[model samples]
Target: MAYQVTLQPSGHQFSVQPGQTVLEAALHAGYALPYGCRNGACGACKGKVLSGRVDYGATQEGALSAAEREQGYALFCSARPLTDLVLEVHEVTAVQEIPVKTLPCRVERLERLCHDVMGIWLKLPSSERLQFLPGQYIDFLLKDGRRRSLSLANAPEEDALLELHMRYVPGGFFSEHVFNVMKVKDILRIRGPLGSFYLRESDKPAVFVAGGTGFAPIKAILTHAFNQGLKRELVLYWGARAVRDLYMPQLPERWAREHANFRFVPVIQSPLPEESWSGRTGHVHEAVLADYSDLSGVQAYVCGAPAMVAAARRDFVARGLPADEFYSDSFEFQGGPGT
Candidate 1:
């Protein structure tokens, strides 16, 4: 049996199958709902159940607290409606209606950006051109039926190649292979353009918040914005633990120098004595809030560790930024035997 789901405010309606989650049904019906880390790890999919009961699958306690559930909140990624339901969800507006594809790509080149970060370039099949928004990500199809996700580090252009920024995670399955056995010309299967974290075109000034390798998608979006001749003032706050973590430092510096409306601020959590670091210090998001006391008219695109994204969203919204204006993608590492 299929259950009917209605969205509040917009009044859009859709039908979901017995076993499908609300997000799956919404996506299948072309409803652009806000979401990230579809595995229920990020709270981006949380929405209020206006009128119907839902069975929330096993979700991390940290993702949704008891207080949130009591307030009628549920994670659309894992919630199965028991009957006709109405929900309060903010839909994403910049999502394009495009068919996703899974294809094979050849690793064209791999360059070490830092001691632990690698820049990987993948060439698509000549016959197929993968169309994806700058902030979207692709998942690697592993032999054991498992998947690993990585964000594209370059904007979509005429080129038939995709760039990815991968960080070496100690003991991570994919990272182990990438750092140890992966080679250029390797054939890998991937599916993508997934996630709704793309930049929304607006006249308001923009603030980009990035942490570690989370800067990958942000970089792509900035490049896309520049290529499209967007003139809105853009400030990028890139946070890292040390100087080495800002692997592609030169790229941002170059962008700031070349793009009249762009600015770059690199923040370091801890600077080594030999690093001679002299820049912004402390958490990246904190630096943003410190500079821009009021975010009422600004749009923020944040990507990074789950903790950083969560903190930025909470603080930014509390400080007057519209909730709808905050777009984010949290990179989660799959834990277990076969990551």
Candidate 2:
């Protein structure tokens, strides 16, 4: 059986399938309901039931008090609709609504995603949670009074461990340390939920272009879009110097296979001599240009080298894409070791 659920204020409606928690249904329906630790440990998803009954399922001992439940409040993360329901809850629709936090985190795990890219996972204190837009980044506060900014590679909903993709820069400060010295259990200070490069709500098709480690934030954005069950046509053009540079290609390949609305195009600028390759070649944006002559109706999210971003902006706008609909974030390697 299924229950119809309506959200107050926004009037957004979705159906809650049996055994699905209200929070799960809302997110699967593209609604951004505020939540933390979906396991019912946090009360961040608590809201008024408005007009119907729910079976509060496994709410932690202190998360939903008896008085709170009696007053018609339920933790959406742990509540299941017993009848058609109307819920009054605040939705996270803008970046400003989330707070920027500076917290201490331990390097929980690390993996070499590619020859030059080191994947780092940071675990925050048990009581701390960082809510961020999918494509935002964080600044790692280094001991030498320097800060290194890296886009978060994981979505807010999957916040158990924050993910960062760091590309090694020869003799560069942070990247070298990340590759050579950083280890699990190392304490690092970070401040963020920063940057404004996030997905905008639109019915237009989306074109994502990523270069090098710039794939980090784009991966997060795409995952969030998928989780929301977005119906818009989505495509990605990931550009790399060689096949080896395209780290984690299988994940996007999986997405292309699973999401009918999605398409993935990998463009390699140069392939190794021994590597027999057949795929799109040249600039990543050029692949988009070849497929799309008119971008007037689509939204483009691009991240990568400054030169590529500039070229895409110029060419895409010339192709009729609205300037405002083009969103981008670019990174450059500094001489001394910064991203």
Candidate 3:
């Protein structure tokens, strides 16, 4: 039998299926309860059980002490509801509510997504969790006193391993290292949960335009939205130089197939004759303009090079999108060893 769990303060309620941990059920029910590690090892999911019995399945004493257990504390990641219960825990609602941290992470895995794009996964220390808002980015603190920033590609709900997509920049320091020398189990220092480009609370439909590897943060935002069961309509225009440049197009395609309110359109700027492609061809923003004659009712998020972002901002605003409804993150690759 499933047990109903109620959250204090917010008064939100969800069901905990048999054999499921509180954190797992809460996440499945679209609640963003704070958690790290998702195991008994980390106390990030520790919270008070206001009024019920729970089977503290495998909770480590180091995470939840005997005294704390006597005080009604339990690690939701390992706790199973014994009956209907009430839980008191703060939900992550905004960027400011999250703490920025400098943590050491090991390169857990690496895969080349395409000719120029590489997928990197960083595993944080088992005792730590980097709680962050979707769409925020992190900076790599290099040994040479240089920093490289990359948008996180995974949603907060799936925090076991952080994901990043890096585009190889020729002769660039970080890009060269990643493409040529970086290896699994290599330790690196990073600081973040930085940036203000996260999705804002609103009733308006959202339109996203991504260029090249700018798809990284947008992927996080979209995954978070889908996991939260957001009902708002979402459309994405992912642009690339050629079909091959779209490293992870299959993901959005799958989302489009699974989500009723989601749509994806891939735009190829200039496909060579040998490419054999039949789809929207041109700049990404132009595709949006052609489809939606009036953008006054929707929110627009554009991420790409400075030139693309600027042009999209200028043209989108002129087309009726409210100035405040438009958000963007513009980036450029440093010619010298930086990303």
Candidate 4:
């Protein structure tokens, strides 16, 4: 059985399947409802149930006080619709809506994703949560008064373990430390949710071109898009030197297999004989250029070396992609993100 769930003011409606919580249905229907600790510990998802009834699935007593529940408020994260319902909630509109935070995080896990890419997972203090747009980044503050910017690779919804992709740069201080000395439980200070490279709400199709670890930000963006069950079509072209260079290839491949609206194109620059490579070869942007002659109708997000970004932007616009629709963030091996 299913019931219709409608948002107040906007009157946007979506169906709540029998097993789905209100929050789950809302997100699946492309609605961004504010939430924290979907486990019902936080009241961030609390909203007024203007009409109809809910089961008020499991939740902590203090999270949804008895008096608050009596007043027609329910924690949407733990609420299940008993009938058609109306809720009052606001969508996150801009960066101002989310606080830029400076918090200490523990190195929860360190995973070597490839020869050059290492995945870092940071765990925030139990009492603190960093609210950030999916593609935003954080600057790790070093004791030497320097900062290294690392993009959050995980989506906002799965933020319990904030994810970062670090490429092993031989002479880079931060990358060298992360690959060598960083250990689990190492306390790190950081300030962020910075950068403007977030997904803009658009119904237009999206084309993403990622180079090396530049896929970090795009991974966050696309994961959020998928979690929201967005209807827009998305095509991603990730470029690398060889098959081994394309770390985490299974992820986008799985996304392509699972989502009808998603497509993944792995572009290998050059493959050696033993590689047995038969996939798309050459520059990542060139693959996009080959597939899309008229990108004016779609949005293009490119992340790579400065030269690649510049070339992709110039050629994309020349191929009819709107100047405004082309967004890019270039990687700085010596500096950091957005530098």
Candidate achieving the largest lDDT: 1
List TM-scores for all candidates, in order.
0.93, 0.72, 0.72, 0.71
Name the better of 1 and 3 by lDDT: 1
Candidate 1 per-residue lDDT, tens place, 52-96, comes to: 899998776656778889999998999999988999999875564
- The pairs that clash in candidate 4 are none
Report the alpha-carbon TM-score of model 1 versus the true structure. 0.93
Residue pairs whose backbone atoms clash in candidate 2: 172-337, 173-337
3 or 4, which is superior by TM-score? 3
Q: What are the Cα lDDT values of the candidates?
A: 0.87, 0.86, 0.85, 0.82
- Tens-place lDDT digits, model 2, residues 216-314: 999999999999999999999999999999999999999999999999999999899987789988999999999997999999988886567767877
lDDT head-to-head 1 vs 4, winner? 1
**Tens digits of per-residue lDDT for model 4, 118-178:** 9999999999888898877888998888878778899998989999988787767787799
TM-score of 2: 0.72
lDDT of 3: 0.85
In the range 154-195, model 3's lDDT, one tens digit per residue, is: 998898999999998988889989999999999999998765
Best by TM-score: 1
* Model 1 residue pairs with clashes: none
**TM-score, prediction 4:** 0.71
- Is candidate 2 or 4 superior in TM-score? 2
